[model samples]
Target chain A: MTYCLGIVNCFGIVIAADSRTNAGVDYISAYKKLFDFSVPGERVLLICSSGNLSMTQGVITELRRDIQNHEEVNLHNLSSMYDIARYIGHKSRQIQDRDRQWLERDNIDFQCNFLLGGQVKGEEPQLYLIYPQGNFIQATKETPFLQIGETKYGKPILDRTITYDTPLEAVAKCALLSIDSTMKSNISVGPPINLVMYKADSLVVRHTLELRLGDPYLAKMRKLWEDFVRQAFEAMPNIEWQRETEASVEDILID
Target chain B: MTYCLGIVNCFGIVIAADSRTNAGVDYISAYKKLFDFSVPGERVLLICSSGNLSMTQGVITELRRDIQNHEEVNLHNLSSMYDIARYIGHKSRQIQDRDRQWLERDNIDFQCNFLLGGQVKGEEPQLYLIYPQGNFIQATKETPFLQIGETKYGKPILDRTITYDTPLEAVAKCALLSIDSTMKSNISVGPPINLVMYKADSLVVRHTLELRLGDPYLAKMRKLWEDFVRQAFEAMPNIEWQRETEASVEDILID
Candidate 1:
């Protein structure tokens, strides 16, 4: 299991991912799940992946091979962010298909998903969630985020806080907090966390941070968020349990 | 799809559930998911269910039938809360087995889960989560809550706020807020919400509240939580994005 998310706001986009990967309880290991493909002045592409590790590695290997071989349709040759999403999705599906038969025979899964976020030199910064089936969906102004795995525990915070007009710094903080919530509740998702913040028109990645388990700043932020949440919960108004009539209250009570 | 939870604290136990049931998006309807069986001075049993509606209804019907027919192992005749949990789990599995073949032939799921909490005359109050396989686990002092169906979106709050010594009223509020979070993130779980609070050794449920979609207290609490969360997010320290060494930051940057 993994937790990775991408947020798109007015200032730019932020992509964050957890580094824990496990084949089973005894086979746990750390693997970097975030990859960067940036041409300093021309384009910037960030890929955050989750799902089957083998399939993700296969897709990444093919992507790099294409770039080194200068294939007709490589990441560096892509004209738009959407094209890059399609290309990644295509590669993911191809890799999964190669192992689908044998993996399924052994009752193993061969699917993987990716969050593609970045800017092509002439295009605006964008974010896309590419599915294992080779289909993809782009983020919209109303829903300015896309998540890949172990999403639900961290989603309520994002649903309430993120928007297209949110500032870049605030968006980065929310992304880290979202991953933090997931890490606390789920053991499959652990640190070090890889985070990247890209300013819209700058064709270079800036503000990249890798937070390991006991990093001081990460620890401080986690404590602060936990304390704030407790305070918030303690402050909510209590339910008026005595105001309702007896008959209505006992409607479902069997005696 | 449903979201129901049972919380046991020092003062008592609080049980809450959403009322939405659907065969599919086109066949949505409302059905109460919480049931109570209290014999004023003798015993008080609460059952909150999630999963296949028909199976839960069947199990409930069997329980009532046993009581009405004066069966040797009915709810009223049970010796302890643990026995009651075992009875409910047995009935649930029996019902599922009855429909298993036919349901599977049509690709339908006949599984269901339950949360059983109550106090019998001479026994201490308890909470149990009964799985589809007819096995159950009781909640402990360290973990005082049990949840079933659509649980992830609402779990973080409970993980952060609930404790064995939490006041009954505060526990009730936390349970409501947990369900509220689930409803906000999942359409499959919705109002009107059912809540019941039982004081330890009382052997009866004293406070029950049904909150409709726009109940004033519910509305106020939701707004306050949302506002407080936003305020908390805004108060967090911003990440110092530029202080790190450029070389370390750019190590993963592909060009």
Candidate 2:
């Protein structure tokens, strides 16, 4: 299992992913799931993957191979972020199709999902969640984030905090907190977490951070967030119940 | 869909459930999902249901019928909370079995999961999550809560806040926040929320609250929680990045 998320706002886009991969509990391994393709001044594309390891690796390898071989439509040559997303989805489907039959025969899943986020030289930074079936959806202003794999645990925070007007730094912090919450509840997702903040139309990755267990800053953030959460919870007003004689009234009536 | 949770602590137990049911987006309804069976000074049992509405209703109806007819092993006649849990599980399985064939023919699911929590005379307060397979597991000291249906969105808070020693009032508030978070992330799980707090050794419910969308207290709590969360995030230390030239030291090392 994996947890990868991408947030797009007016200022920029932030993409994050966990690095743990497991064929089984006993076969756990750490693999980098976040990959970046940059042309320095022209375009920059980031891809975060989750699902079958072989399929994701294969898709990434093929994507790199396509760039080297200068395929008709490679990430570097794409005109828009949407086209890059479509290309990644197409390549992902191609890789899965190559293995689907043998994998199905062995009762293994050949599905992989990807979060593609980046900016082309002339276009706005965009984020897309490409499904296992090679279809995709872009984030909108009202919903400025997309996530795949073990997503729910980290979602409430994003739903509450993220907006198109949110600053890039704050969005990055929220992404880390989101992954931290997911890691706390789910064992399959773990450190080191990969994070990147791309400024809108910068055409280059400016800030990136990888947080592993015991990393000082990660440790400080975790402790601080947990403490604040507990304190906040402790400070919330307790439900004031009605008097026993008046309990028959509506249940939410307070005092 | 539904969201129901039960928390057991040294002080007592708290059970909460949202009252939303949907056959489809077009066919949505509200039905009470929390029910209690109390014999005054003897025992108090609270049942929270999630999953197929038919199966849960059928199981509840059967349990009521058994009690009314004075069956040998009705809820009031059970020897322990575990027995009552097992009885509920048995009835759940019976109802599913009765509808399995027909439901399967129509490609419909005849499954329901339940949370049973209460205390019988001479027994300590307990909470059990009964699966659709008619098997159940009780909450433990390390993990003092059990949740069913649309559970993930609400789980991180419980993972962070709940414990066997948590005060009942705090646990109740935590349960409400859990449901509130779930409702924020999942449209299928909504209000009016039903909450009941049972004090240990009392064998009777002491406090219960039902909160709806426009309920003043609920609104206030929601606003307060959201505000506190944002404030907490703002108060957290930001990631201090290393200089680009020194980035090779380590992914998380600060300058």
Candidate 3:
């Protein structure tokens, strides 16, 4: 399992991915899932991949090849963020095609998904959740973020707190905190985390942090969250029952 | 969809369930998902269910019939909470037997699950997570809470805070808050929650709250959680980049 979350707002973009992967309880590994393409002073785009290792690795390799060859569709040369998403989706589909037989015969799905986002020189920053089917959708104010992989576990926080007005740093924190939640619930998604924050129009990979275990800040945040939760519990309203509707064991029994 | 969560501790037990059902995004309705069989001064048992409304409702209806018709086993006469869990599991399998054909033909799953707990006379408090196969597992200090149905969204806080020493009111508050997270994220669970909190040895349902929409305390807690989130974000550690390697993007491309 993996957690890849990105929030793009008026300020910029925040993207994070967890490194844990597992093939059941016995086999676990750490593989960085966030890849950034930043031509310093030129462009900074982020790609977070999830799903089957083989399929996503294949897609990433293809994406890298395009960069090495300076292909017209490479991340550095894309006309818009949306175009980048389409390209990613296309690459994912291509990988699936190569494994089509195995996918059907062995019930193996190369279920690869990628989230691509960033800004070009002239347009506003954008984010897209590129699907395995070679289609994608951009983030809008109504839904200002995208999450992939083991997404359901961390979605509630994003749903409640993410918006276009959210600051870039706050978005990054939210992404990591969301990942933390998943880590505790699912062993397959333990940290070290890859977090990238891009400032709008910066044309540089701004603040990128690698949070490994024992990172003091992450530790403190976890503790504070625990403390806050305790406080939240104390603040809740007390139960006000109209009356105790008591029923006897005999009264609840049948004839 | 539905969300039901319970916390068992030395202080007692807290169980909360949302009453929402949906056959898709458009066809949505509300139905009670919480059932209780309490013998006021002697024993108390609460069952919170989530999944196919038909399956869950069928289980509850069957239990009611068992009580009125003096079926082979009934919750009211159960000597232990563990026995109650087995009884519910048996009734669950029975319902599945009768409805399995309709579900299989339509390609729909009768995925009824339950979170049942309470005190039965002499035993200390207990909690169980009942699966569809008529098997259940009890909660322990290592994992003091159990949730069913749209549960992931509401699980992070429970993972961090719940334990055997947790107070009855605190656990109750956590249950409601967890339910709130689910209600906000999924449309399948919403509004007017049904809550029950049991005090050990009292064997009586002492605390119960039906949280309707627009409840002041609910609104306040939601806001406080949001504010804390915002605050927590600002406190995240700053990213530090050391003597940067001439760059890694090139290596990624070349490789």
DockQ for every prediction shown: 0.42, 0.38, 0.37
lDDT of 1 by residue, B81-161 (tens): 888888898898899999999999999988999999889877878999999999999999999999999999988888877
Quality class of the docking in candidate 3, CAPRI style: acceptable
lDDT for each of the candidates?
Answer: 0.88, 0.88, 0.81
lDDT of 2 by residue, B1-255 (tens): 899999998999999999999988888889999998877567889999999998899999999999999988899887998888888988998999998999999999888999999998899999999999999999989899999999999999899888888888888888998999999999988899999988888765768888887788888888988888888778878777442333332342221
Question: How well does candidate 2 match the true structure in TM-score terms?
Answer: 0.94
Give TM-scores for every candidate, taking all chains together and pairing residue i with residue i.
0.94, 0.94, 0.92
Which order, best to worst by TM-score? 2, 1, 3
Which CAPRI level is candidate 1? acceptable
- The residue-level lDDT of candidate 1 at A145 comes to 96
Which residue pairs collide in model 3, if any? none
Model 1 vs truth, CA RMSD: 3.6
Off by over 4 Å in 2: A242-255, B242-255
Give a tens-digit lDDT track for model 2, residues A123-176: 888899999999999999989999999999999999889999988888999999
Per-residue lDDT of model 3, residues A53-172, tens digit only: 989999899889999998877877887777778778888888888997887798875787888878877788888898888888889888989999888779877887788898766777
- Indicate whether candidate 2 or candidate 3 has the larger TM-score: 2
**Number of the top-ranking candidate, with DockQ as the measure:** 1
What TM-score does chain A of model 1 get? 0.93
> What is the i-RMS of every prediction?
5.1, 7.9, 6.2
